[model samples]
Target: MLSKEELLQYSRHIILPEIDIEGQEAIKDSHVLIIGLGGLGSPAALYLVAAGVGELTVVDDDLVESSNLQRQIIHRIETIGSPKTESAKASLESLSPTIKVNLLTQKASPEVLNKLDSERFTLVLDCTDNFTSRFLINEWSVSNQIPLVSATAVAFSAQLAVFNQKLQHACYQCLYSNMNLPEGNCADQGILSPVVGTMGTLQATEALKIILGLNKADTSFLLTYDSLDTAFQRFNIMKDPSCSVCS
Candidate 1:
């Protein structure tokens, strides 16, 4: 049951016909693990907290640098020296004290992956920029039977997908069978601020849908967007029977 404060805070969601009180309650009871606190993770974390996800675990080892201020809205100039996880935790707590925030001050590693208790999280959000971390997350999600919402953005382009072994949806590896990392990093490629924000927000939306069971109709679809042309595209993704990670 939500407290009077929660009910008041989430009145907008409760009033929505698509997401009634029950959906809002599911969001309030969901636990999300967000990997990375950079471009894509920033907006996703903010929206997830604002949408009343009960628990959030933010994993990032980097500290706030002056260069990241333009795209990482969660970190301010004053927080330049502070840890990214600390800044995100403060932001989320300030936005909604009712929500619980966990800060993992280290980069997520295969060792760290081993330490994760799969049962604790309802879903994992892969906001990491690199392919190594992305692949690791995909493999971990498949092995643990956890659902993962992955998003990536660079140079006005973005992609979003949901992978769940339990649901038998297409895993991330199914989309890219081979590991070929993006050539330039966001730091080098120069990402448009709104591009990352849009992708991250969409990722949060997908995560919420997964938690609320609204994704039952369509489980394996890839959504891509190009901010330059304002074009959005969706493609049906199939699970690779020979996938090394999930198969």
Candidate 2:
């Protein structure tokens, strides 16, 4: 039921056998919530918006800083003092005027997530940098049975994974224990600009695949990438029976 403009706009996607008109429709019907606007969230948001997702709700409390420009591709020099959420919304809408971009200019909280979940978010993308927010988002996704795509990039390395309540797989909390955690973020640890971009791009791909019903298998593996070595690694994610969130 695409308009002539939509059909022509998404012609490349509709032409592909993997994502024909039906898949494009599903893409347009999906509502994705992204919880960050930094390195990982930047490219993920751009690709998802360009891919014609029906609606996007982006959450970020930070303002644009000069240092962020190197990795945060969604913001510009003129927006350096702007809130990340407002800046990202303006940028995304500029890309696709028809796409809906909701802005939450504050850190996520249980109450806020509950309100959004009630409105029926199709899925969530955990693009946050800190473990606190990741864990919080993971718990919400798990409890609500919404699938989550989580990604991280720091110090030339990045990680990506999908966690779903419907699958018999490890939730983010199962793998990310307090004792075993990533040390620092790009601010102190240092990261190549494109390395974070790569991770964010991959995050969007997985999210789109899930929304299109193309990912039939449980994609719970911990996928890691090292920009320096140009290497990729995947490790199995075994569900911890004692996982408080998923158990």
User: How does model 1 fare in lDDT?
Assistant: 0.88
Q: Model 2, stretches more than 4 Å misplaced?
A: none
* All candidates: CA RMSD (Å): 1.3, 1.3
Q: What is the clash tally of candidate 2? A: 0
**How many collisions per candidate?**
0, 0
Model 2 C-alpha RMSD vs. true structure (Å) is: 1.3
Query: Could you tell me how far off, in angstroms, the CA of residue 203 lies in candidate 1 after the best superposition?
Result: 0.6
Q: What residue pairs clash in candidate 2, if any at all?
A: none
For model 2, give the 10-residue run with minimal summed lDDT.
111-120
* Model 1 worst lDDT run, 10 consecutive residues: 178-187
